[model samples]
Target: MSASPRARRMTGAQAGAVTARILSAAVGGYALAYAATAFLSVYLPMERPDRVSFASLASFFVWVATILYVFAARSAWRATWVPLALSLLLGLAAFLPGGYGVRP
Candidate 1:
């Protein structure tokens, strides 16, 4: 039988990787989800209320998927950087060129 979690010892690298996955799933995933929601809200061609609702709904899935990806990634570094990069890209897409600040 396999050892219990408390009985099993993790190496420093294993612990660090787990920590990175957790942080990436929480913080990075939220950032990515927020960015995706913003981008979708701006670009989805629905009416305002419908667009917002759809984007909000989609963001939940995005967050869950990010969490899964973070844990499933081959390396902690990949998990960390991929979501961060995607969030930045999505944020830029959402905020740039649309003059989003001046909406009446």
Candidate 2:
């Protein structure tokens, strides 16, 4: 026999977890992509066009990896905090004075 509707439906916590995972995938993934591209473009020792192209490709991979990591994490807290921390670190590295492009 088929289960009742209530039995098949997700509980409140399950729904919240799903929502958190989706938001993490969207926002966290974008943050990771942007930070990675910015850092790579500045740090890589390549011509401008080549560096940009490489950074763009690398950002795509970073974004995908972020999404996968968010879903695979055991808890939503880790999924959110880890990427947030990494993005902040990368942002600091890219924007700090004498960090990337500053010349003596």
Cα-based lDDT for every prediction: 0.94, 0.87
Q: Return the top candidate by TM-score.
A: 1
Q: Which pairs of residues collide in candidate 1?
A: none
Per residue, candidate 1 scores C-alpha lDDT tens digits across 1-104 of 98877897889999999999999999999999999999999888889899999999999999999999999999999999999999999998888857757432
Give candidate 2 regions above 4 Å deviation: 1-7, 98-104
Best candidate per lDDT, number? 1
lDDT of 2 by residue, 17-83 (tens): 9888889889998998999998887788999888889999999899999999999999988888888
Q: How many clashes in each structure? A: 0, 0
On the 0 to 100 scale, the lDDT of residue 19 in model 2 is: 87
